[model samples]
Target: MRLRNYLLTSIILLTSLPVLAQYGSQKKADNLFNKFSFVSAAQVYHNLIEKDFNADYATRQLADSYAFMRNPDSAVVYYKKVVEQPNVPIAYYYNYAQALRGVKAYKESRVWLKRYKKAGGEINDEKFLKDSDFINSIFNAKQQYFLTDVNFNSKYSDFGAYEHDGHIYFASSRNTGVSTKHIYGWNEEPFLDIYVTDKSVNDSIIDHKSKLKGDINTIYHEGPITITKDGKTIFFSRNNFSKNVLGKDEEGMTNLKIYKASLIEDEWTNIEELPFNSNDFSNGHPALNNDGTKLYFASNMPDGFGGTDIYYVDINNDGSFGKPQNLGNVVNTDKNERFPFINNEGVLFFSSDGHPGLGLLDIFGTVSDKDNNIISVLNLGVPVNSSKDDFSFFMNEDGLSGYFASNRNGGIGSDDIYAYDRIPQLKIEGTITDITTNTPVPNAMVTLLDSNNKEIARLETDDDGNYEINIDRDTDYIINIKKDNYIEDTRQVSSKGLENKVRSITADFNLNRIVKKVTPITELYPIYFDFNKFDIRRDGTVELDRIVNLMMNTYPSMIIKIESHTDSRGSSKYNDKLSLDRANATYKYLVDKGVDPNRITEYKGYGEQKLTNDCDDTMDCTEEQHQANRRTQFIVIKME
Candidate 1:
């Protein structure tokens, strides 16, 4: 009986060799594919197909290869074929469902998703629900969650991404650092360079095809670029090689420096070193404010939480900088927190590895004031993060879709940039008014236009003189409020900079009255200006141009008064003189811009006499409200 058992075991071992070999080859291919080596894995899987025509493992892996290559159609073909086989693992259906979702087969994705769950499949549930990739389809499918895999680069390790003016700037360690001079092993290259790319609306991404007409490329480690809204200024992280004679005995490396450059007439010059940067500590990841007047960044300097702390600096009027202020214990912890991003509305977003999250490093957003006080902080959670390190997130103008860099699983290479469209949460609202009565007009027609100024939605005002419209995030929209007897009022909302927040716009409409030459001072919105300034800033330009255009068209035969005011910052007599000069300057500029001088009336300045604030600079009053006391405005006094 013992001899018979031994014979049976030997026969079993001999028979299992072929099966074991086949499993080993498939496992190897899967491993290679997971590491982003699709070419080698595809070749191996191809060989397996030739050896065993009945093997389905190789077929699944081959589909994954096509998916890694971004050929979703071929991936779908193989994935669909795998589902037809009996007794396959539930992961096949789950993964195939994700692939189907990637190719935008919402109905089919729901079918496989339901099948996987029914077959007891479980993995990455949060990804299915939260990832912006399937947001549209998942909502359409009425499904809660789905499975997702990242697509990375096979040859290069991308670390950072910044979007501006229809182009993308990023840091990469691919096909570079061949020489020993710039050598850093494992994490990244010694000289991580910044590369620019033009991403089209289509799925095609082109590198170095942007119209960046300057020496943006540096020999040293020049990376992590943050461009301003106008694309005129750039703040980048760089490592400068300076001989450290006293700090080190011998063989010391260079110091890391953050540099600022301005684009002058399509060229980058006037490169200046930021004073807030310290030599002993590494200061990088500079995030610029919407107006480019402040910078939020990460530094390892003293008086931090422990590792790296987020800091801020104010750019002064004379182009100088103030002392760096550390963002306190709320937003930053005693960890290697870095990669700061500040939105236009002073919302701060960053990545932190030590924070409680679903991934190694999760992206977090916080609301902050000008004093660097963190009001609220929230982790982006599952969809925006993963088990691996996730960082370098940027939202586009519409806040819906943008590029983020990550080293997550199932990527094309080491680290690849992924463009994700955020699920939109938008609310459109307005009030309708009578053309002549100056009261609410019920049931007025309203049309919402998209970024290209195309009509997207329509609504009507309620009896309460209010209307609300819902929309997706990341959409450039225009609100066109029209009543039968009134002029069509069109307004625009720039959703490009608003990624994950609600935008409120008041679309107030006023119909043309039956009375001739309608001119109402109370009806016009109040215009505010800074102290001792005649030139309108960008924000002020929007409102000022509206008044200018109104006067030029509606009140063409009228004479207007340009009035200026000042706070009690100086002596009343001196303030009055300065205000008069500013008012005259504004008047001349308008005349030069083609506004008829005969239609222009008197220009007057009321310095300290017409002060808006009760307290002067010498009195016990805050400087903030005092700054608001100064102003420039116009009054249509007489009709020609």
Candidate 2:
């Protein structure tokens, strides 16, 4: 039995004789909901609440029905009550959060999102919360596209605009005025069908529109197609209907599939489902690469990272296929990601509710490397997206113009197709070099900040010391450059008044290298003692005072070791004792001059050894040469 029937039977068996009427009403409403007639089910559920009969269950079901109908305003009202009920399902918290976002209650949505996480909801809530500022950055981004609604929109749903061979093909639910027209129960709208029209001469007003010529437009839902460069083959999404029968899964729910059709004699014929279609899960919204060697689509197959993830299959030269590969976590999230469109430049554009956005679904563009690895995902920002479902993006080879769909306010229908022209990107490019050497400073950190000092982009310079970045027109930015052992540099730049004319700006930086000696010794006269004496002499005191000034004031954290030596004229045993006393005497002098005892790491004596010159007993050297051997040396061990 279906969940509705089982639930109804349970309610009937559990209820007493006094509440049969209430249970009877619930059974009727549950039947409508089970049949996918959400509009009718919502009305019945509302009636149950008005009569105060099992209002809690009625309210929860009512909210779900409205959500199925895509009416968040109505859903939020009942969902609020459902969530406040004791022991409500944890999923309801997530549902409530999404509903709040639909109404532009972002702050309230985040609050519920936190509650959902606290309730053990299994989403990457921590990352989502930490990226809240990133969402705000997208909202505050400059407008990139100029959008206007197309004139072909209808009072019902109309979206998914694709242009091929100077004509526009789209999906619509506009009534065909047929007496036997089928109605979709979920939204109470007519079944979607593929429609085509000539490209508007004025780019917005369509002279005429008609159903696509072919068997491709089924009585069931169909549309959102992609055509090859040769224009001979077309791939489109359709209900899982074949051989005059609608296919369903084990749970009695229909799923969508991608179908291929050939253009023969001005008619689309030989329609066939792709080999990957299944009754268990949906695979729809086909997109093609520029060369048509790869086909991309959205699916909800098992082990997917989200409700729906974008997958692509390689179309081999012999007309065979490769296994589908998921686009991975960088693009897919725990929410729906759909409508994959790859532009001529190989950039992927799709709509997602998963990524942080203004609200609902928003269009985003991908930046990939030469190996096709995604490096970054960029939100298209306002005018192309709003706090509503925006998707079905299609861009021309030039990339400066495109079309998209949205259900945002002021649309002529539930979803309307909008044409847009992208503004040319403004950029800043430059190199960083060392000031003294005039050489490139590779791998230097380059940061771009807005007028308010908020970071917009941060990257490292390439091997050539070159850095390039895109910026908004008519905005002020701060460029900061930094590298190790070099002084950081900052420069202010402005794109104001440049508008769409000037495309690039140059900003270079020259950093000064920090110069410091690494050796332990400081430049000073040698500290020499009298013959066989460890006491401080007048000449030795001069050098000792300089060492005290350096250790006590210049570098307080500096640690040094004292090494004392003696001339070869003294006995080895006698010289060792004299050198030891001299080393100790120097250590005591520095300590008495207010230097920390711990700063002197060691005091060592090397007698009649490590002579600077050949002044041993076998050679008769001058008195000055012997004095050099009696000197003390200070070796710095540590310095901060």
Candidate 3:
């Protein structure tokens, strides 16, 4: 549904006009305001209480235009000047509230929100309710206890504070060097280092500091620290200043590298460099998956969205690192992004100066699935962010209390840490089972969905076929259950205002046997393979395992011939050998995994001789259609 303008249609524009006796116009300021054209057509309302001051309708208009341009900070400053007028419109406060929200002044935003409501300014209540920033402010104020002053000093730039298990880990630039005084060009503050602080101390009156493990602290740049959910592994940034890795530059410092420190017994030891560190580029600000199978970090490597990008390095079977793959443009930009944190819910939190923010670098978060598909990147507005470089974020399962670093004064140093509590909006859960037999379908995938039918989570049924999904407590969600030999099932449920409780929702599906009339590959299609190679991916082998299980259940005594073929793109002789290798690879995988080799008796490679279509060998065919010729089939030669 199209949103109708809730307020008066006559949107006033701001511009400056010449008054009596002042022959010269304020050309520079007027021109500056005009250049920042707004997307929506704005009126030229004149705010003319000025002789030489750069004030007018356009100045006011420019502030509103800045909001449209997503430069909320500029808008806030201009709106502040406009609201000072004795007789300004109530709408000015309303627009100003939004600008305050953009810069992450939640309390100020709330004050304006109240003013907007008091003045009877029009707004979409539904939209306001759905605004994560507005909702989070209310949540933090009610559920969390914000930490007051952390007694440190004007000696560091601390931020990106987060909580793991029970401890708080943050980034700071506290004197750890013979002459530890480095400055960030952007904020002109001291360069950062990682720090840990505790939450058990009195926060409102005074802030206590946490100690670092020995001299684990480095003199070079360090930030974006994270601890595993189990509280065993600690990951943090280290500027790669290794003498061998980066040949001593004029500054004699290497690039940056993310290091992992593990806790063995009660002591943290065995500090080692992460897998993807190199001498060429800087790689830091790592975010680890819950299972520790994937590591996400930011880098300025080639083929990135812009400057620094978030990259994923998959963990190999032997715990070694794989090639780092860029997370693509979804989570990255040409702008500098730092301090990435991943919650147990798979939501990602980071700080960026590129995306429009209320200040220099504000904290932002995006809800993502296990596959890293981003649903939205929302600003953590108000109390959490401000008109300064507010970053180094952390959160708990409850989404209430967490810590972050900032330079908003009232701290021990150039930057200090703060903590706040918040309320978790809502969540969902359910189970999937067999309808006819009332038995659990182990390993079945149960997905929770939103209004757009986007899958939020793909939970697997436990050994007994019981599945539980945790989501925000008050949102609506759809459930989809998919299992082999069972009909696909879908259901929708709303958890609006539902308290934190395990909702018992039973989604039972009937098992449907494989009927010949149905599409055979409905269970299998679009098979995967390596680049220019016929070997199946590990996941493809898993898929084939299901096929093997199905064949064994349906025809226990059946003798089948496994045939593999390849597209006619290459020479027939080469195609023949490739096809045979693929068939042998599949056979070996099945055999090694305990599938009876005798039941998969014959293995044949047709060598592009068998075409599902009528295309001739030399005919020009699309690669997709050619793929049809390169296929795998199991023919039941004999069944008992």
Which candidate leads in lDDT? 2
On a 0 to 100 scale, what is the lDDT of residue 322 in model 3? 91
Q: Each candidate: what lDDT?
A: 0.62, 0.76, 0.59
Per-residue lDDT of candidate 2, residues 1-640 (tens digit): 0011000001100011112365456656765544334566677788878987656567777876665555668878887998897645566677777777666788988898789889776664354434433322322223457776578888888888999889889999886555677899999999998888888554433322478887898789998899999999999999999878999999999999999999999999999899888999999999998888999999999899969999999999997778999999989999999999988656688999998777999998764543557755667777888999999999876566779999999998899999987554456778788654457998898887777676655668878888776554545668888899887888788766553434466787877665456646555455888888999888888888988888788777666778999999878999999989999998899899898887776798998887889999999999899988997888765555
What shift in Å separates residue 52 of candidate 3 from its native position after superposition? 65
TM-score of each: 0.44, 0.47, 0.42
- For TM-score, the strongest prediction is 2
| Candidate 3: Cα lDDT at 512 | 32
- The per-prediction tally of clashing pairs is 17, 0, 43
Cα error, candidate 3, residue 451 (Å)? 30
TM-score of 2: 0.47
* lDDT tens per residue, model 3, 1-640: 1111111111222121122122123223333222221332223223233332324344555566555445567778888887775435566677777678878887887798788778776555455533544323222222122354455333556666666655556666555443546665767765665556455644322122343564345545666776766787777787764433433334654677888777787555677887677667778878887677788888887677787877778877787889998765656778877777666555667888886566888887763432446644556666677888887676665444567777764566677777665432222333455543345677877776665686544556667766554343334557777787667777666544332222232334443322343323333433444424777877676767876775567655645567887776778899888888878887787677767777675787877788678655768887777766766666654444
Evaluate model 3: give its lDDT: 0.59
Task: Give per-residue lDDT, candidate 2, residue 134.
Answer: 34
Off by over 4 Å in 1: 1-154, 176-183, 186-190, 201-213, 242-255, 368-372, 426-468, 471-640
